[model samples]
Target: MEDLFYFKLFLAFTVGSTMVTLATVAAERLGSRIGGLIGGIPSAVAISLFFIGYTETPQLASEATSTIPLTMGLNGLFLVIYVGLARWGAWIAMAGALFFWVALAFLVILLNFNNFLFSLLFFILSLAGSYLILEKGYHLPSTEKILMPYTPLQILSRAFFSGSIISGAVYLSRVGGPIWGGIMAPFPTIYISTLIIMAKSKGVEFSRRITKPLLVSGMVNVVVYSTAVRYFYVLFGLALGTVLALGISAASTYGIYWFLKKRMS
Candidate 1:
């Protein structure tokens, strides 16, 4: 049982890491908008929910799904903080953002909000509020130039780091229970990693540009995917439920990307 659990976690980690790395590379090759859209696809969320439902109970998985929107609300808070203070320095900005992430996450779990409808409402309001706070006077950079090409070592490192974060979050779900599990599900592994790299290489403005769309699109993906998983997990069982949830999430993401791209253009 123990070995099997570890194996599942390893599998999730691999999937999460690969997806994130691919998104990051795509963001580098394409533009920030495209990158943000891909980054918003909820790779970690999907992997965690499916494995949790598969290895644990569907109830626990549903409970975790219930909290994801709230957790994503908290993630919006993370981005707002990080972008607001990014001029100071990446480390300082990251520190301030993480402080809020931890605090907001704790507050949500303390409130013990379990209703899917209520959580979805909160998620929508929080996302809108956060976007308003961050989007004021925000403008995308005009040029699509790579500051630096990622070497093989850098790509591998990103994959390893993302994989480790996903693995850790899964392990934490067991220790912290479903609510805590859900709270940790949207840990900004990809966002923080990509932001740090961008900040260091491309500068704060570049990082901020990418972060705006990433947060907006990510919130949309989480809301839709979590809602689907919450309702369908028990009805269809883990495998089918996961497939349906991912399908909904993917379709939603594409629609959002189109809307966002059109609006921006």
Candidate 2:
């Protein structure tokens, strides 16, 4: 049990760090909107569910998805809070957003929101609400490519920050049942890292610009992956299910990027 626990934590750290780094680099090279699109692709939840299914039971992994949609909905709220407070400062925005995420996630777990249909509905509402708030309300414009150069130390530090947070989340998630696991699996640690890095490197405005695109990405990518895996893992087994889910996610990501690019142009 102890060995497995450590392994899971390590895996979480690796996935969290790699995903954030890729998103950050993508933003720096491509642009914030593009970065947001990349960021929304499945990261922690994919690995989390895969490992949960591998180590535990496929059924447990499937059960763990019971609250994933609701948790993802909360993640959308997380972005909203960050962007809303961005003008104040990056630290303030990240801190405030994290507070809401932690508080609301706990509330979700306490309430035991395990119904798939309602959770899915909540997720949809969140996506729509977030779109309105960021795009229509704030009208945050997309940022140009940020020309910031990264040092090894900077990359290492950002990875450490994301890794530690996600490692903790992964470790604690297993303590409770599948519902708790589901909720914690999609914790906004990736978003927290990506937001802070982008804000600090480029500026708060750049980070804010990406929020809308990120929301769109979240709406399509995370939802598709989670929903697909909810059934795929059970029907096809862990390895095949993960591959199929990822294939679907990748295709949707391409479609989303194309749509967003057209809209932006």
Off by over 4 Å in 2: 1-5, 8-40, 144-150, 165-170
For residue 181, model 1's alpha carbon misses the true position, in angstroms, by 1.2
**lDDT by residue for model 1 (1-265), tens:** 8999989888878887887678668866777557545655787778777777766777688888777887788788788888778889889999999988887778877887666667777788888887777766444442232344776777888788777776766777787778777877777776787788788788887888776666767778877988899888978888888889889988898888776766566
lDDT string for model 2 (36-76, tens) is 45655776677777767765777788888888888888889
TM-score of 2: 0.85
Q: What is the lDDT of candidate 2?
A: 0.76
Identify the leading candidate in terms of TM-score: 1
Clashing pairs in 1: none
Clashes of 1: 0
